[model samples]
Target: MAPKTTHPVLGARALNRATLDRQLLLRPASLGIPEAVEHLLGLQAQNTKPPYYALAARLEGFRPERLSALMESRAVARIVTMRSTVHTHTARDAVALRGLAQPGAIDRELALFVSRGGLDGVDLDRLAELARALVEERPRTPKELREELLPHWPAADPQSLSVAARCLLPLVQVTPRGLWERGGQVALTTTDRWFADSDGPAAGGPADLDETVLRYLGAFGPASVKDMQAWCGLTRLGPAFERLRPRLLAFQDERGTELFDLPDAPRPDEDTPAPPRLLPEFDNLLLSHADRTRVVPADLRGRTWSGNQAHRVFLLDGLLAGIWHLDEGKERTTLTLEPFARVTRADRAALTTEAERTLRLMTPAGVPHDIVFATR
Candidate 1:
């Protein structure tokens, strides 16, 4: 066997700065929404508001209407892609990345359905074709799609049928559901129909996976293969990285796990001052890494999750500091900052200022908003 490659060692703080800089979290980026979305690979958007909040926090002049227009114009879309969850991705990535992730997502969905006897005699290929036809005709809510598919697979569970299609196909969540300040049911369309005007077809096979690995490294790297797997729910990506090894930079974290990143990516000094900022629920920063200690303190990791949902968290000095929630009233909105540990006076003041700026980005101009720190 070839001798083990020695890489630079990066402590947790150094890794934290590198990741934050790449994530556009250490400082807001100057890029437009679409460019930023592509760079980040996509934002966790199980809920409509998180994408807007995420971009607002990361972009220099992000506006809710900007993202809304992207959705309205088919420049970006909400789709079930990474980690088998809804993400708001640029239209290009919505197509390219979904195809890369579909195989595993579909297998998991089918396994669950089969174990429950919900997919008992249904032919998945036929189901996919039929589901594709239905969604292609027009974007339909999961309920509406389920109802239509039920007639064909009458014995299969309605929910399972809809989910199988979601897993198997590249379905894009149509506008209004993901539109800023607009509430609507989750609706689905095929990527092909949704981005018909785009250059090439949705990417597939190993080549796209290679692209995905590079993009992940660019956005969240100095990460291990396990971290990439955790982020995208795709396994066996080691070979993909191996192929690009010469083009990549390698590092070892404090724990000795080898990390891979783009050769030219930023790795800032460990002492870099990370600003106080609030992250949206299920922010990728918390979810993207298998070893998340770079951003989340080991002692506080267990606290970030409340059942299945991860709460919106705040960061100070590039580490998880607290959780926050918004209380929107008709006339005024209150942002409550709840810290996990004792905060110094200086940190608290900075936290308050960041919270106020976040409120301005999140709420309408005329709407009043206030920031309150929850007393321990």
Candidate 2:
């Protein structure tokens, strides 16, 4: 049987279904840890520990321990890889994809610290030594490390050289620390101490490049080459796309922009019923695309994507419903929704009721928390 094909113009529904489907949020979370990680090309790990909940919400059968176990055993590693941020990903991916995104990582790190004193009078070799000595054996917080390094880099600012040197070199923050519901604190260690072999950089096609593009398309495609470039931070998807052109399925959007995807991947009916769902800060669905209109509402985009400050969000008939902030205190855990637009009283009430239920679930047994809707 021929594979099903979709026309290029994927509106909010198509985009939402694709996003949810890829995120595994549409279906109840059922996949194993490693499988889930492989599917999303890794969760947006910049926040370190939060992806576990992001995964748990999507993968019904998630075990927080599996990821920590992967991190400890080195089957997966915490590498300063994609988007030039810290993420815990399968070791195989860290080895392969980091090479592609390293330049961005390096640039971001350098820009962060160089101005304060990263490349100043001090010797870099010694700086690396100092950083290693500070964090070795045990993971250290950026704050704690900064305090210790103050004597060495008293003149340097935290942003410029401190974060940059780590970017240029390979390092991994140890975990057990990042597992779900666990008290996750940041700590650094050399990637070699854990994963040992670093994936060296290699130029396009015939190598991991094609496989990388295919994996990306399978997990995040039906997207343009530009989207692939944005997610991977790689400029050479042209050649990778060219290499896979024959095997890929293509369609032109309303603008005639070509989009590609794995021929065998799922593209559910546009009529698929999408439920209201909550997403973590830095969720990949929002960050993966160059044009996010399909999943994120323009009005709510600026606020909800602002990390924990934006809190959680809701998918109202597949469009964003602005930002949500959850406050958990001794007596109760409260959830507040900050909508970007005027929701009908009925929808507002319904959302409030659901938020209350969510609060109850988040804090079982004791006093059920209050869920409130607030105007932005």
Candidate 3:
């Protein structure tokens, strides 16, 4: 019998550097907005601005308007793909990933609603067909959708009816809803209708889950099967990893967790310099892994969240160092940084510099900005 291949080991710092390189945070990459959006799989877009700020931190020459234009042009869209949460994805990924995730994450989410008795009497197939026609005819807000869907299932819970619509269909939050500086109320439409006029890939097809695994590794690799499963909110992915093993490089993390990454993917030196970054709330880098210790220090694990909400975070030396928020004013925008611990003058200066870059890229020109370190 052939001897089993022994995997090499990777320490935490080594893993952090490798993951950061793939994340495009080792340095700003010169990539266009649509390409970057597709490369990263998608940006965690629980809020309107996270995707733009996410691109600004990872890509060179990124402007919020660039992403906004993609939204307007239907080259990218906000949809529920991974983790049963909304993400801003490229037009192709928006279609493929959603279809791939539907069998697992999306179905499970709808089951949760059904289990709660909210969809007890509703025929799901009928609901999906009606909701698809309703939204595809013209986009509708959650309220409008729920109200329209409720009468058909008068016995069903109103909130659950709309949530069911979302879970049942590959709904896209239409333009103006996610546009920069031109935000509007959440509106819903079928991905088919939303991408109907675009030259990009059309909606509804079986996405190759194996191909998705490779893309997942390119963007979030040096990751374990569980990591990708956690990132995408799917399970039973071990077969995919096994199938790709011959083409992958395997290494064990300190905990003996086997990590599989693309053979040519960058694994930067452990001590490679990782500059500070200011990330928006719910950024994927912080959420897309089972072992976040690669980026989140152990002691500060739960500090980035309150109740169920995530705070915008800043990284010092490529680890979660602080939480930050902005106070926009007519004359000035104040960026308040709250570090978990005291920092050296050098670290503080570096954080300030990154904060300035973010403000310049995200805020309107000619708006004076202030960076304040709150007393921890």
The TM-scores of all predictions, comma-separated, are 0.95, 0.79, 0.97
Candidate of highest TM-score: 3
Clashes of 2: 14
In order, the Cα lDDT scores of the candidates are 0.86, 0.67, 0.91
Mind giving the per-residue lDDT tens digits that candidate 3 earns over 154-262?
9889999999999989999998998998898899998888998975776658579899899889988799999999999899999999998999999998888989999
TM-score of candidate 2 on Cα atoms, chains taken together:
0.79
Question: Across residues 1-376, which tens digit of lDDT does each residue of candidate 1 receive?
Answer: 9997777899999999999999998898999888899999999998789998898889997788888887888888888887789999877788777777776654676688878999898998998999899999998888988899899889889999888888878888887788877868888888888888643244433227777788899999889999999998888888988998888988898878999999888999999899997999888989999999999888986887778877888999989999998999998898999999889999999999888888777788889888888953
Model 1 residue runs over 4 Å out of place are 1-5, 197-207
Candidate topping lDDT? 3
RMSD of each: 2.0, 5.6, 1.5
Model 3: lDDT equals 0.91
- Give, for candidate 3, the lowest lDDT window spanning 10 residues: 198-207
* Model 1 score (lDDT): 0.86
Candidate 2 has an lDDT of 0.67
Candidates by TM-score, descending order: 3, 1, 2
